[model samples]
Target: MGWLSAGDGYEVALVEGRVAARATAGRAAGRQLKSLPKAVREHPEVDRLRRLAEWLDRHAAACVTQVDTWMVSSLPVPTGLLARVWPDEAWQSALRDLVVVGEDPQEPGFLRDATDGGELRLVNLDGETVRLSPATVTLPHPVLLPDLEDLREFAAELGVTQRVEQIHRATWLRPEGLAEKATEVREFAGGSYDSRFALAARATALGYRVSGGYASCRVRDAGRGVEASVWIGEPYWDGDTETGALSWSDENGRTLRAVEVGPVAWSEGMRMAAALHAGRTVEEGRTA
Candidate 1:
């Protein structure tokens, strides 16, 4: 049994060319990567890891994936790489496993001062004293990077670099909240692309403000890369889609911003839309 449960949050699973399942942690188990796109490499563990990275990278405006765990909040994800997600509580228990349990001005000074056992304080080249934590992170399982040396080799195989970084700080709109906003947006943009409106509306429910009008979502490669145009009210439209340009407008049907939404970025659009809806500044809501 996977982690999905009847009432658990939905996690999208892409197989061959279809929308495989809306899974939870338990339901996610045993779901093969038969449908994931070619951009994701084919090894069993690599496939799952890529999807998880893609999911978090695409859906959460700001998120981090390390070797052992994933963190998607304002808090920094301790540095470490792993093959699976770890339970949050284990962070404290496995402090010694961290790459750096260092102290920062942003962190709670009390917590930093509380730990005196095996803690190391060192000054950097800049002559800044920083207290390092003793925790270390370990991977749940070993992962393969057969193409680690050559960038093109890895990019050719994985369609993207196989590097994953721990997030130090990220802010995002909650997914459930975004679903609710989509409802309001659907009413705002009534047209043939009602589904797009719904999807965007859901994103709005999560707090993303729609800057561009709307465009048709073009699904390709059996659903590996979904493309579309969305309006993000900022200096410019954001999205690195390859399919084509998205068309959106206002009450006057004037073109606001037409952008390409890629399979990986579409998920990010949902998260970005949420941040916009919440009235967060573009710079403040960016993901690392």
Candidate 2:
């Protein structure tokens, strides 16, 4: 594999005529190609690598989109299918470290590895690593995972972030003791979408991550971070979905009291709600 300039201060390496990895120009320049001219910016090989890099990026995105779709729709995915795609770096990156359940949905575990023999390696709730050869596995939504909070903490300690939004999706049950302490910053109504995917698309366009039927964005202010999330329904393509509620949470997945929420977070949450509301479709009988 050799490094080549991919333009815009980025560099990619070609491995067997395929883009293997990419990095900033600083990292790509060294003993391989000390100068930009020697990098052969217009070489056919460099062009091929650039195209391969774009293709790989799209493939990775498609993999993540499909996996997220499966999780939201509660669809079953065959183990053999996963094993087949695991060899592909993009697909593997999207599938790895996600919470998956075997044929029996009740027994969910964290996906660690997929073997060539069509077997899956996972870490169970009891913190045990075991190999499973079920006919199929399902990537359950974060809401369906009982040990989600614990898993999130563990994942944070390991510095593992999933592109599929399993561990990073913040969730919290309304605390009874904090009921009096809690406050509502904004309540939006009449913001509805034709389907969950439509809302997710808008959220994704707005630079938020869709996870567990919600579109969430994280903001850091004055060294403190907060996540603002707006709930959309499950990923049923034809099913109607509407904004449920907007919420803010701390880094540890604890819901923040309205008073505790900063102005930046509040405004951002309202902005997201309004943006989603603007995209709401008017029913046939309703007049705009």
Candidate 3:
């Protein structure tokens, strides 16, 4: 909900409030960049951050302005650890005000935004809709870091203790060193790289055909055994936004089973694949 200025620091300003300054990513460039931190600049997972930062620099002024209290389209911070910074009072206040005047935009494949604007709105090229709800807060990109302390604090202040656990329900899938393989599976699985690839590789290695969402020997399953299917799409419901759920069918076109697998990272997904290859299921209905 704030903008990092072009100067030697970051400047964050809320609506109708004074702009505040503190050393920011700019400060990191000098001391931190004396040598790129392996975890950030050198790690394969962080290449996107490096690439995005380069793109943002090319369009500095335009990019910075995207940081409204409700919506920011550009990738300012890395989707990983950089997003885990302690939530300062400014951000908490802005988010608190945001929860009151708007409903969360939970539509899949549609960009949702919330800010100090009159109300919470979900807009697409078709039109826009607004609602008043205090039990709502727009879902931001998941904080990729493992630690959830800061996020817990924010949720507590918002009086949404459930959100603390909800954060664990989302997943991120970035396949390092397997970019080409990941790309192939993502396309086949309806952009579900994590679940599909993780499942497919393990199944194929164990002898099965790679189908739309599952690796099975038969396209249809009768009543003999459970014929399953997984749905891959962004999930949003009841103000909770996690990755999609996995669905199964009985070949009679009747729903058989479905289970949710909270958010999963690519690295974690791969581990699940390894488990499947080892003849172990990951304690979830979805593949990985």
Candidate 4:
């Protein structure tokens, strides 16, 4: 957004509310030394630049979290709000190319750009770009989007990577009679502090992708890959925090028999479950 200078001899440009690019302002700027002398390179100005970069990275991450929350909740966003934030590069990058549904809901389109006058330019399902002035628009869940497959293909052609989760996340309904199902790979009893986000965060830290309100990881053993998933519940941030389930399946999502699960797969699956369980809060007069 602006250029900030360190009193010594360095200046950095803040773009989109983040430190995007930097420039040296004095003699140091012109020096082409393969390596700067320790005295010059280790100056306070250099430290200032390092600190500024770190802060910028954190700010950018927070921006992403806020946008992700909006998409996950499927919140109805006002057209005016979109136009106002669209100018920020961070917001623009996250919003561009996401599938959005207007008031009609059924008629979905891919957002291509945000125009100057609170109008959204989108490519409709019929492969035509049209501008719409809806009162509110929603970034629908992938399951609710009728033309998801087509959108994925189009994205591939355009080499676009969506920052939003919808297109890439897989959705699944709990299988019929899952409670009466044959086998349980693992289960984590929820804790008081173990909100959906906390559990999902744990799963993500373990390199799993969160989808369909579940945190899942894939493991390969004996030449076959199996996915282990833990369901923390829908609207994971809300709802009862005392219950959760874990399951394992093949690539096609077929439930695997306990006997069919490899030793390593079983261990990893249990490890995830136990870790989550350990983080649970034990409340008095509560039973699982």
Candidate 5:
């Protein structure tokens, strides 16, 4: 952004997300100051720039969140929508380098650019840039990508770095032989925290919601909604608490048996459970 004149002999602008200043008539004219000068510290132009920077930060975060949701759900997004939003710097940063699957299905590519002319430029696994105008594209979850390892290797060679986690997001797979009638999985049970508040805080920090005594994640799988939860104790409790069994419930709140959970739901549920467990306090060789 171009600098704006704050007062006399000085101009101010947002630099690296903060208000910065430079002299206009002195020896240091046209050179950025190491810190904001007191003369313009409370200036209206500087305040406006600071607010704009803050708003831009929030906008960037929102873009990453929306893109992350689309990837996690493996939902198809309209190509036109991508092209429309591609002009936005925030959206572009979040969507770039994501693995996108178009009509071909078998040919997954790294999203490179989206043009206003309704074309998408992508770098395929074969290390070639290709243009496509598929009606829609899917930013597939890493677990659903058949050639995940290959894509990861290619991304490394291409020096790909995505602002939002897609290819490198943690994932867990449903194991074979879960008891048919098991309504909850105890795989991540018995994680202890200093207090219920601490456990709930960890869950929230990890981007899960706290409701009642459970830290939960709601996801749509196979056209149905399922909520995965791990017990974190009652919200009002301040005493020590232990992470409880992980479970899944339908949108209507009916518990689902292990065998009844869909693949995506199962994987997402396990991912949540594993994440909560990873934060459990470890005491020597025993879990605290």
Candidate 6:
């Protein structure tokens, strides 16, 4: 933000998301000060600038959260909608470099830009710039992408780093013909924590809901919604605890078997479970 009149000779502006001061008329004219002068720090203009910075921070976070939801769910987003928000730096950062599929699922490209007319520019795998104006596009989850390893290799060569995780995200595939009647996965269980609060805290920090002894996250996949849950321990339990089996349930609360879980759901469920497990307290002299 540009400097604004704060007082008789001082001007204030937001520098790198923080309020900074400068002398508009004096020996250090036009020079930014190392610290805010005592007088300028309490000025109304500085307070206003501080509030604006805070709002910008929240706006940026909200943009990232929205884009993350779209990618995680692999939901189809209208080209028009992306074009509307493309000019915004926060939205652009969260979207750029994400893989997008248009009318033809066979062709996927890294998102580069969105035009005023809703056309999208992309960098395809062959190092060619391409344009697409499909009515909608899907940011398929990593597990659903074909030749995922190849995409990772290509992205690395280009130094493409996404603000949100996608191509390089960890994923797991459900084993084929696993017990059709089984409703739980113990692969991430047996993780020990010092207390239930610690285990629950980790889940909460990971953006999973902690309620009634279960840490869970909901995802939409394969045209259906499902919730993946892992037992963390009862609320208010102060004793040491350990993670329990992971499981999936439909919107109607019907537990799904290992074979019944969809690909994205399975991957997301495992991701959540593993993240919670990774925070377990390790014993000394043993690898975490």
The numbered model that scores best in lDDT is 6
Over 4 Å off, model 1: 1-70, 74-101, 106-131, 136-271, 274-288
Deviation in Å, model 2, residue 169 alpha carbon:
2.2
Higher-scoring candidate on TM-score, 1 or 5: 5
Model 3: per-residue Cα lDDT over 76-185, one tens digit each: 22212112211333333223221211232233112223334323333322333444324433334333323344444544554442212233333335424533322122
Worst 10 residues of 3 by lDDT: 69-78
lDDT of the structure predicted as candidate 1: 0.31
Mind giving the per-residue lDDT tens digits that candidate 1 earns over 91-163? 2323222222233422211111113244444332233445555343112111111222332332344333223
lDDT, candidate 3, residue 216?
A: 38
lDDT of 4: 0.66
Top TM-score: which candidate number?
A: 6
User: Across residues 182-222, which tens digit of lDDT does each residue of candidate 4 receive?
Assistant: 55643454544446676666667755688967766666544
TM-score of each: 0.20, 0.55, 0.21, 0.55, 0.96, 0.97
TM-score of 6: 0.97
What is the C-alpha local distance difference test score of candidate 5?
A: 0.89
Give candidate 4's TM-score. Answer: 0.55
* lDDT of residue 22 for candidate 2: 48
lDDT of each: 0.31, 0.71, 0.33, 0.66, 0.89, 0.92
When 1 and 4 are scored with lDDT, the better candidate is 4
- List candidate 5 segments past 4 Å from native: 284-288
Q: Model 1 reaches what TM-score against the true structure?
A: 0.20
